[model samples]
Target: MRRGASASHLDAAAAVDAALPAWLGLPNNAEKVLLTLRAARVAATARGVAATALGVAATAPVVAATALATTMAELLQRLFELQEGHKELLQRHEELRQRRM
Candidate 1:
């Protein structure tokens, strides 16, 4: 089951990499980096959603709910950072491509 999930994730990453403009000229390793970043962002988003759901469903105490919200917010921040990093990597890839031309 775990292996299947990993394979699914890899397939998703490959699809995302393939959809990007080839003119960007990112290498395979760079593509992998993008994939990892994207996965991290997704995980963070899932965590945030789960946390929110749990808080709501459990009727957590105000303090506990606040903490969960804060954690979820931090996860969101991490996701944004991962996205930014991915963008930077793509930008760098493009710059390198232009330089090679």
Candidate 2:
């Protein structure tokens, strides 16, 4: 009975091993299929990372342009304020001169 049980277990193991390649849809080359699948996955991951990097690179010019526009607007506002202050000082100086005369 012990010998019979061991023989049955060995037969079962052999059957499973024989069926594995067919179960995985490979023609007696499961290792090749697994390696191909791994390579495909790595290629897909690399493509995704490259696409993200390209998206960031494409947006860089727009970001720089927006920053430059903002800086120019601030500088223009400061220039206008300074011009107003200068006009006011000139008016005050003219008034003082007339009073002295």
Candidate 3:
């Protein structure tokens, strides 16, 4: 009877140990499950990174076009400002000539 009770106690203790979370300490079965979960998480992260890289690759052309358009707009604005300044300078020169005459 005493030997049977000790065996039963050990079985109960083992059951409790197995039921405990992996973070405390894991038996073989729990360790396997934890490893699988970690692998799955890593795979998910890798897939997300791959998707992001593809998205950036797809948008590269659009981004370059937008940058080009912005540069052209800035250049046009500078040209207009320079033209306006030239017109003002010509008008001032004409006024000075009329005064001299």
Candidate 4:
């Protein structure tokens, strides 16, 4: 909110970062990131499996590219999840310490 981010965007980002493990912070968001990772992984695997089963060996490069893209997406998602959770933590810390006086 301090960033002047739109309410809906903030809420959507929060929603993404919720439902995850407490270890990941914002359980919901973490879960979302994990889900995205899982989905991407599944897609990559399916592409590979399909190509192999179809015996279209010439498509290996394309399949590999798809897998790489998915992997990069998963990494970026995890980074965003971590960043969003950190913002909440920093705000909480600032608020709590202010009341200690």
Give per-candidate clash totals: 0, 0, 0, 11
TM-score, cand. 2 vs. native: 0.36
**Candidate No. with top TM-score:** 1
Give lDDT tens digits, candidate 3, residues 1-101. 69999999999888865553544664535544554465456555644554465565432444343443455556556655664565577579879999999
Q: Which ten residues in a row have the lowest lDDT in candidate 4?
A: 19-28
76 Cα displacement, candidate 3 (Å) = 0.2
RMSD of each: 7.7, 34.4, 31.7, 10.9
Question: Which ranges of candidate 2 are over 4 A from the true structure?
Answer: 1-65
lDDT of 3: 0.58
| Model 1, TM vs. native | 0.42
Model 3 residue 96 lDDT score: 100
TM-scores for every predicted model: 0.42, 0.36, 0.36, 0.36
Which window of 10 residues has the lowest lDDT sum in candidate 3?
Answer: 57-66
Error of 4 at 77 (Å): 0.9
Residues 1-101, candidate 2, lDDT per residue (tens digit)?
69999999999988775454547566534534544554456555544554464565432444343443455556556655664565577579879999999
Write candidate 1's Cα lDDT for 1-101 as tens digits: 69999999999888866675454776646655665677677766666576566654333444344565677668767867776687788789889999999
